[model samples]
Target: MEARTKNVLEPLAFLFQLITGILLFVFVIYHLYVTHLAEHDALSYEKVVERLANPSFKVAYFVFLAVVSFHAFNGLRAIILDTDFGARNKRAVDVLCFALFVIATAYGSLLLISF
Candidate 1:
C-alpha cells in the first residue's frame, strides 16, 4: 500500500492552513477584546493613533493581516481542492489562490499604513 497525493505540497499546505487558522483565532479574539471588551476607549481615534504609532503594534498588525489573508485564501483553496474542478486543476487553483492572497494582503497593509 502507498500514500498518494496529487501534489507533494498537499501535506505542507494542510499544515499551513491549520497553523494559520489557530493564529487567526487568537488574533481575532484579541481584536474583539480590545475593540469591544476593553475598559478603555480602544476604538477612539486617539487610542487608535497611539497604538499605531508604536512600532511593535505596527508589526503585530502586519502579522495579523498577513495571517488572516493567508488563512482565508488557503481555506478557500482547501475547499476548492475538495471539488472536482480544483482537483483536476491543482496548478490553476494554486496560482489563483496565491494571487488572491498576495493582492488581499497588499491592499490590507496599505490600508493599515494609511490609517
Candidate 2:
C-alpha cells in the first residue's frame, strides 16, 4: 500500500509541476503583452490595477501564485535531491519544502482575500 501510494503521488507531483510550469510560461507571455500595451499607451497602470481588482482576476492570481510557489519550491527540492546535501537529509529537505509550500499558499490566499 505504501509503495502504491508513493507511485500515485509521484506522478501527481510531476503533473502538478508540468501544469504549473506551463501556466507560469503563459502568464509571462501575457504579462509581456500587457507591458507592450504600455509602449503603445494602451495599458495604463491604473487599468492594470483595476483589472486586478476584479474578484475573478484576484482569485485566479491567487491560485497562480500558489501554484507557482509550489512548483518553484518543488523544483528547488528536486535540485537539492540531485546534490550531496539531499543524500544525507532527503526527508528533512522534503519537510522544509512542504512547509514552505503551505506557508506560501496560505499567505497568498490571505492576500487575495484582503485585496
Candidate 3:
C-alpha cells in the first residue's frame, strides 16, 4: 500500500478499535450492573432476559458483537504481522485472516439473528 493509504487506513483502524473497545467495556459494565440488581432482589433473571428481548437492546447487542469481533480479529492480524509469522508467509497469512474474519462475522451474525 502507498504511504498515503497506509496513513489513512491506520488511523481509521485505530479509531475503530478504540470505539469498539470502549463500547465493549460499557456493555460489560452495564451487564454487571444489571446482574447486580438480582443481589438486591430488585431484578430477576427473567427480567434480564425480557430486557434483552427488547428490539432496541437486541439491535444494540448485535452491533456491539459485530464491532467487538471486527476489532478483535483485526487486532490479532496486526499482532501476527508484528511478529515473524507474517514476515514468513505474508500473503498466505493475510488471505487466511481475511477468510477467518468473514467466516466468523457471518456466523456471529447468524447467531445474533437466530437467537
Candidate 4:
C-alpha cells in the first residue's frame, strides 16, 4: 500500500516484462523459421514428429513454451493492473497470475516432454 513498497516492486515488474518481451520476440522468429522456412515440403505429421524427436529440439521447444507462457501471463497481469478494480486487488491478481503461469508451464512441459 505504501508508495515506497510499490516503487520496489515496480522495477522488478518492469525488468521481468522487458526480459520476457525480448525472449518472446526471439522465440517467435525461431518458431517462424523452424515451422515454416526450415521445412520447405508440405508439413507432414511424420516430418513434425521427426523434428521433435531430436533431444536439442525438444529442449528448445520446451524453452519456447515456457517463455511464451510467462510472457503471455505477464502481459495479462499488466493489462489487468491497468484497470481500477485490478489495481485494488493486487495480491489476488498476483496469485492468480502465478497460478496460471505454473499450470500452463506444467502442461506445456508435459506435452513437450512427452513428444
Per-model TM-score, in order, reads 0.86, 0.73, 0.70, 0.89
Q: Which stretches of candidate 1 lie over 4 Å from their true place?
A: 1-7
> How accurate locally is residue 77 in candidate 2, as Cα lDDT from 0 to 100?
83
**Of 1 and 2, which scores higher on lDDT?**
1
The residue pairs that clash in candidate 2, if any, are none
For candidate 3, the 10 contiguous residues with the lowest summed lDDT are 34-43
* Backbone clash count, each prediction separately: 0, 0, 0, 0
State each model's CA lDDT, in order: 0.87, 0.80, 0.73, 0.85
The 10-residue segment with the lowest total lDDT in model 1: 1-10
Name the candidate, 1 or 4, with the larger TM-score value: 4
Better of 1 and 3 by TM-score: 1
Model 1 Cα displacement at 57 (Å)?
1.0
User: Best candidate, TM-score-wise?
Assistant: 4
lDDT of 3 at 23: 85
Global local distance difference test of model 1: 0.87
Better by lDDT, candidate 3 or 2? 2
Candidate 3 vs candidate 4: the lDDT winner is 4
Model 1 agreement with the true structure over 1-79: per-residue lDDT tens digits: 1235545578888889899989988999988887788857888989888888878878888999999889889989999
Give a tens-digit lDDT track for model 3, residues 8-108. Answer: 86688679779888888998786677667445642666765676667886777777677767777778877886789776775676578778877887887
Q: Which residue pairs does candidate 3 place in steric collision?
A: none
